[model samples]
Target chain A: MALTRRDILVGGVGLAGLTVSGCAGSPTTGGRPIPVQGATAPPGSPNLLVIFSDDHRADHLGITGEVPFLQTPALDTLASEGVRFDRAYVTTALCSPSRATLLTGQYASRHGVQNNLSAWTPGTPSFFDSLAAAGYRCAYIGKWHMPGDLPDLPGVERFVTFTIEEGQGVYRDCPLIVDGVQTPRPGTYVSTDLTDYALQWLEETDDGRPFCLVVAHKAVHHEFEPPDDLLGTYDDVAIDLPDEAFTYQTLLDRNVWEGTAGRLQTSYRRYCETLLGMDREIGRLLDAIEPVADNTVVVYTSDNGYSWGEHVLTGKRWAYDDNIKVPFIVRWPDGVTAPGTVSDAPVLNADIAPTLLDIAGVPIPAAMQGRSIAPLLRGEAIEWRDEVFYEYFADFPYQVPPSQAVRTDQWLYVEYDRGLAPELYDTVADPQQQVNLADDPAYAATRQELSQRLADLRREFT
Target chain B: MSAAAQSGAGAMPGEAARSGPVGSSSGRAWRIAAPAVISVVTFLAIDLLLAALVGRPWGPAYPLSMDALVLLRMGPVFFSGLIVWPVMRARGATRAQAVVGILATPLAFAIVSGWRAAAFFPPLEAAYYSTNPMVVGAIGSQVSSAGVGALVYALWRARRHRSGRPVSSGATPLPISTGWSWGPIVAIIAGTALTVFAVIWDGGQHLFYPWVLLYGSLFG
Candidate 1:
């Protein structure tokens, strides 16, 4: 195909237009991407404020119309200012694996640390360390579930840690020890105590320095006990049962921990009550950062998703949608595209690190398995990954065999070693994942393709 | 057959008697054989297996004979598979329930067993009873074994009543309540009691019958 005179003339004009615009005002990318509607902090510098929650779900929010009794005005404010990732997800569903992947920009298998049994050791080159080295002051508050042995970190000025309930620590009314002294309950609650400490840190911290503050909360983990103040708030409001809540239809063949509807409903109600408390606490933390809102980037996310009895399974060990997907929101008023636009780009916990590095103008390590979310931030056409891999190794009580999965937006392929079989679900059609299509004749092609991809992923990561 | 001939409890008359002189009961002696010896041996083997496989996992603190789950494990198989719905008539349990029961019971048993395995076997309702996986087997493994032994005694009673033609008519068989059972119960009690002394003497529960009781059920 030969270039005509008209085609050459048109190309010349377009190229000439870009050249002229580069010299004027703030030179933004011309034809490569749609100009982001929100403010872009000139070049690469922005305050990072990551507000992470545990076991919180996107659909559980009051704005989502599912959990109306809940109050999350701060998270709501962040979403109002920036894009709420309507379908963001954690690579793995368990706690440590999820956080490890987020920090290292790699899946749990590559990192070789799966559940709460193994701690995420320092010297592992977390993005936090990279940000600190790049001259950003960092502070991590709230539950450091990874490992409590905080090694000397250069840039992190504040660190708070607590083990979850049942891990040799009491959760609700128990006194929390900070720096080796058992701090008496300021009042009659543990959740408020932690929040007060975090809020105090925010107010007392030295200012004028670019900072990255991560506030991780343990509101909704287990034995769902809220502070006395928030205890009866959602009691009057009838808790909306998660769609798969009370599945009394026991498969007559498969044997498991036998539980009754009274157990499931009672637990689900308590789970929501705990979430409601966390939602209120989030509002408190947001009010803490309201003064520096312009320069700050607030991201609200959870470690992993939890299940409410879908497919007769009651917990978070499996790689089903209910357990793997979590809420991810990025609200940097100065950065991020589409003041309120949502994208279907698949994001991993690993990408959280590089995305921060990209926002902070820190170079992403070549060894990192995650690609930065920066391109998506600029509204550029990013060749984002099509599928994400996930896995979990055994932890004491959850001593199930290791499992691996490949999840596309539409399809999820998994293998449960217990059944010694592979399962495939087209989440597009069956979000409930009632039917397993791995053995279906029609899905042989799709399964084969996904299987190959899963194999390739394991090999590359291994 | 007359009551005397049918009993099979006596010997035949002396050689001086005519060919068919014994009061006729007919040739009905072939209908029976004593199942007592086999029953007790089977009983011992099952208990040993239960103790070895299920009992040891709970730990060495428990002696083999006192595991309550041994009863639970056998009761369901007995009531459902035999008595209530005889194996021939009753619906058996599914494979999954069996696996869960088999797998978890051993853990539960071992835990219960170990709490005092070194101290010897305690009754199911002892101080540690509430802490262990309670037998809820109403009458669990040990009692089930006792029941088997009692059935044997009943058979021995019926077997001894013969009176004619080498099988007697005068001797009366014993009642089920008359069997030599307290000995076995006391033997188990003694074994458990001795286990405490043994552990204290040797400083370990793993010393006694490591091969026969503990290792056999776990591996074999």
Candidate 2:
């Protein structure tokens, strides 16, 4: 049948309206249980697959308006199919510290992984162990930047992690440690290779027991390198620099603004390119798990938020929003009914373990600092913490001074321990944090209150 | 130059003889162009106001002061004005037409620029944060400037009327056919030099430095 212009226009509009209204179909749930011999498992223990990316900021997602032209269809599809947390943050913006928080559900101080160099001694309790104890099979793949001497862990039966280029992991030709065995990879793209192992495990794992899989991608990090196929996809696209880039008053003393601004476009383009490759791999993973998708609780997030000179600084050690805020999207078909939902309630990397345990009906350890946000995911009203504590103990020789901050919904109080002036921002009014109200007489009362609250938080967490 | 010398005294400047002003008698161009210019100016003013309120820096920090930041923010808007003025003048727009264009700058500036910004950031969030006094103050300056522009145009017209000169399109024909002007040629040379310096000194991102900065802020 021949279609008229009006018909086409109407159909287009209708399709767009549906997408905007989140008309994506809900996943199937309550399937027949897979029987396991000699296992005392709860009726429907859903599988868990956590897809973690390194140094990815929250806004970088296409839906977040980070880079306007960058299209992350896979991630956008995931958010539309699940719940996206708008205020998700990391305890520390370093790789190891943040990863440790995800593992232990505790702050850096409690976990003893204060810096990137600090190691988590083998047998230190993680929620993975709890899942294993509850008759679930666990596997970890890709950039396991968590510090530890032993390649083996309590629950992770398959440990396929990359360790090359001083633990940053290489984009290409990277070596992998597969269950304590050294494997040389020649000219293999790291993310693709890691996914290969993860899919293999997902396919070969004993079907009786529910599984926990971690797939971490080392894309979109510093020295941004995309796969060969994606290298020139964004070469012609123009990037709009921010207004602050012109008059970078914050970097005037350092003489680094011009240098940073000049290379910003090339660096950011490479970043988007790399992210695209990762997104493609994620789509493949989703395809591979299509049958069990509804019964699996899929979580996607980053170890830490990264910065490409938002504050005239490149890297993630700072207390800025871009450096600490991370994209957090969780999809559990059986449990979460509110599809395409956005949660403004504060959540942290430390909350991952407790929440996963809660999902699996396991008891949260008393030692865990984070409370499970399972109720929040189910769209239930639950009393939640108003503030999140953030700490970055000095990377001493690197000159990154130690700082602790308490970020409430309205206020942000940062105290630098190196005798630097404190920073206080009324986030509701000044989201970009241009004006520091720390020393302002008008905000003296608010400052004191936030300071006291911060002190109390430090005492509670430490 | 030869065209202006041949035409009568009422002829406007800076044009080829045949292209002085199209359809001047019907006033169609002025009717179309006047509101458009006013709308743009008003939108830019509002954009600046919202920018101040949001306190959102569009790009990375540069090595410039607060005053410099303010100037850089205003630069593009002013540059657009430079292009708009000559077009309206050449169209033989009346004093009232020019006044309407000038006076309508702030609101138009806010609406247009605000719309553009909303595409990148949430409109409500952008507007909510833009409730700063500094943004209001910036809007005030824009409105005041537009008011001043209208006043100047009115005063000039009144003076011409009092002197019994015909209310002709005030544009004067430029004498470019005789010889090239030193001013524009020198500007072109300077601009070329600056671009060359930008390519060599500023990370080689773009040949034109300001364009690089502008593009970088919007999409980078």
Report per-candidate TM-score of chain A alone: 0.81, 0.87
Model 2 spans with C-alpha error above 4 angstroms? A1-39, A147-150, A246-262, B1-220
Compose the digit string of candidate 1's lDDT tens values, residues A348-445. Answer: 77788888888888889887888877778678886778888877665432324467888888999986554457899999999778689999999999
Tell me each candidate's TM-score: 0.61, 0.62
Scoring only chain A, what TM-score does candidate 1 earn? Answer: 0.81
The TM-score measured for candidate 1 stands at 0.61
Q: After superposition, how far is residue A259 of candidate 2 from its true place, in Å?
A: 14
After superposing candidate 1, which stretches have Cα over 4 Å from the reference? A1-44, A66-71, A147-154, A164-170, A177-188, A236-262, B1-220
Give the winner by lDDT. 2
- For each candidate, what's the DockQ? 0.02, 0.07
Q: Which candidate leads in TM-score?
A: 2
Could you give candidate 2's per-residue lDDT for residues A312-357 as a string of tens digits? 4556777878888999999988877798999999999999999999
